[model samples]
Target chain A: MTELRLMWRNTRMVVLCAISAALYAAVLVPFKVVPLIPGVTELRPANAIPIVCSFLFGPAAAWGSAIGNMIGDFFGGVSPGDLFGFFANLFYGFIPYKIWEIISRGEGPVIRSPWIAVKYFAACLAASVLCADFVGWGDNLLALRPFSLLGNVIIFNNMASAMLLSPFILAAVYPRVRRGRMLYEELMPEIKPAPMPRKTLGLALLVAGEVGAWITGNLLSTGYWTPGFLPAWMAAAPYDKSVAMIVSPFMLLAVVGLCLM
Target chain B: MKTTLYIERDSFVHRLHPTAKVFGLFVVFWSIYWVDNPLALMPLALIVLAIALMMGAWENVYRFRWFFILIIVPTMLTWMLFYRVGKPLITLPPFYVSEASLMFGFGRGLKVGALVLASVLFLSGTKVEELAVGLSRLGLPYRLGFTITLAFRLVPLFMESALTVVDAQRLRGYDFDAGGPFERIRRYVPVVVPVFMGALRKANNMAMALEARGFGRTHRPTSFIEYRMHPRDAAAFAFLLALGAVSFWIYYSGLGAIPTG
Candidate 1:
């Protein structure tokens, strides 16, 4: 996460960040591979760009993903929910490389074997779930859309791109980036990983918190399960109060976990 | 493709200080966020329309006509699934169409539509540089703001190069539209790889160019354009502040809420 701040100090990292964002918005605006939710979202192959860039550019990719999505939102429509969308994409790009760093034990994200492939999928899934949860929880909190609708669709949209497109892109681009000595670790060697025990615990919390938020968001938004602790008024239809009450702590936990990592 | 929503207009809205415009954007979103009644949302919609008409931003608005429709319709339908209140006018399996639900859904749609319109107006009126300057004035770091402005400048370039790659591939008898949705997306790998590699090849030189020109030699690098607050800007800020206050008052008075009985 320190890299996120440090990347700004280096001119090359700033250029790389701009390039990453430009590539994302370029692919995002013109290409609508599949429209999953009409105006809200689509199955964007462009989603893979962040994951690919994340493996290559580290923190730059995270900011790139956020800003790129902001550019895309400008073209489509911007809303208060897009503030959430921004952070959602930030995590979407941030989580992959961080998780990969831990799970792969400092190895590159180019998938060369079955075990590596599973780890790759896990990283993408974690990223996708948190992204979906953030957007879903936000829309539902605002009473704009049901959490289940966005929560579920975005996961599918992100995963579709990650699973089907990102690996191929990474496999093709990683070695060349490494050869050019342009990978984040190569560009900014000052960044040191946290102790393994803390990072592992952070990973555990991240997974648990994200998964909990997803399930709780879905349940609360659907009116399937209302927690008894909330007042009756808060538990009523639209369930905005219920969602704010129940889902937010999990989201906080996830953020704290990311900070730890 | 035209990558940005900005139009080169010399309207009063365009001439306003970037910080005021940025704050205006937040005020609009803040105003819209407090209401969930279609009727109540109409005033802001009409205000946006008036601004658009005043600024001759109808071109961008007209361009996004279908998108506005798409946003409104699906949003209404999606809320119908979850906002089950009032007497059922039409009871379907998953959807319960009631007066409250219909009004609530329409209100949500209008709210989202208004937010989008406000954003479109903002983007149409504001340039990328102005946005960065506005954000910087509002406390964004200089480097991050520069990165954002640079990314905006690069989107069209990247998109142009990507289209060139697609054309070259097509000339070589490569079919981009040769299969199902996922297959079609997968086929973009070739197009993406070249653009990705091309972008990276520029990164080193771009960094060197910035460094040679003293990119980060100082904390607050001077800009080519300078902005100062005017009487109009102060007036606009006051108007926006009042608008935000009125919105909160509406919410507190419960005039913005849907009657779900």
Candidate 2:
């Protein structure tokens, strides 16, 4: 029993990883509201779960987070990226864990901040973005077809989605997790949190939102929402056509202007 | 004894690379689309089944045998009625089953069923790693290859998570297996929410872990998992080439000779 206690003590880390997988899969798939939620668009934030898991429990836990979500999502009949979706999620899990222990530990306020909570929050958020990119590229390459994972449309949608959703989650969960208050009774005492200027998080959100809006307009207005799914020219169809109509003179002007110039 | 959908064996088909298997499947699918002669397609389908058997995939076939049987019965009846539609040999009040219609339906169904089974044969047997290896070999990048491998690796992990979640629900007095569709759906929320949450957490952790690690550190790293092509691989590749040639020949030889299933 005592042996089990020692084992179970940190095993919750795996459970945390599992929960992370399930949530990402559920929010992105089976339930429609995730997309409806506005900015939490891409499957990349899901990367954060494995990131934290890797930090706390190592590779196995991180992997578990990736795999666990796929299984959960499949049984739920989530959107069909088929095999590509599952693959990106798995390898991406290792990224965050490896980063913290290997490289990022020496960097910035991330390491020096008195409260470990904000540090963890930021770490996970970063992990998710990188993985999301992995999903986009990997999906196109592996599937031999574009638009499997994030593709341009979803990736653009996800960027908007991430800014809106990530911070709230970071704020709500980071303090408890960072302080170690989430551990089972007997793990350890909670760590103190560091003070931050008020509304700093708000400013981050504001900036992210503006950027998201700008990109969405540019990407969507083109009427070609595909990055990999559709060729850039094809994806730029609506924009091209609309812009063509808007600037049809360029065609006639190009011949005369180039000749004149 | 059960000549079910999946044919488990240790023949050349089984020995084929997972990537090759995927390619083969696609070729078969493409062939089906091109061949209008159902009869000719039947033989090809049978050949695929035979190859599957040679590969020692009978166990997998047996698992889905009942499903095929269920499909076959309905299909046979529909074809029989269709083939005899105008000449209805039997008539009942408010329900007249035509022999022509029955024959047509049966034939249509058998063709579809056989194809579905053939697909199942491939899906159940091929390991995801093999697929990744194949795709990578076929020009997918290492990142994509690893992504596919990682995805395949996650399947078992998610399955295990699911079992635990089921057990947890059981402990909480939730009846997951036995219920009406609505009940089944409602029960799923508990299952889904928890599972989705699990995935989300993992994605975050993984991203952080990856960043911490040196993933995407350089353009590309030397591959540790290398697949060298030997003479046997060349021979197999040649055989597929020949198969493609024959398929093209059949297409060009004449559309009329293709038999209808």
Worst 10 residues of 2 chain A by lDDT: A140-149
Q: Indicate the DockQ of the complex predicted as candidate 1.
A: 0.85
Interface RMSD (one decimal) of model 1: 0.9
Model 2, TM vs. native: 0.47
Name the Cα RMSD for model 2.
15.1
Question: What are the clashing pairs of model 1?
Answer: none
Q: In model 1, which runs have C-alpha deviations exceeding 4 angstroms? A: none
Give one digit per residue, the lDDT tens place, for model 2 in A1-261: 121123222334334444444444433333232232122132333323344334444444444555545544333222223344554455345434433433244442123344554554544444444344334333222211222223344444433333333333444444444464442222322222122232234224323432343333334432334445444443431232322232223223322221121
Which runs of model 2 end up more than 4 angstroms from their true locations? A1-261, B1-11, B14-19, B36-38, B70-104, B141-144, B177-179, B245-261
Write candidate 1's Cα lDDT for B1-261 as tens digits.
787788997899999999999999999999999988888889889998999999989998998899899999999988888887999997587887999999988898888889999999999999889999999998999998998889999899989999999899999999987888899889889888899999998988999999999999999898889999999999999999999999999999999988988
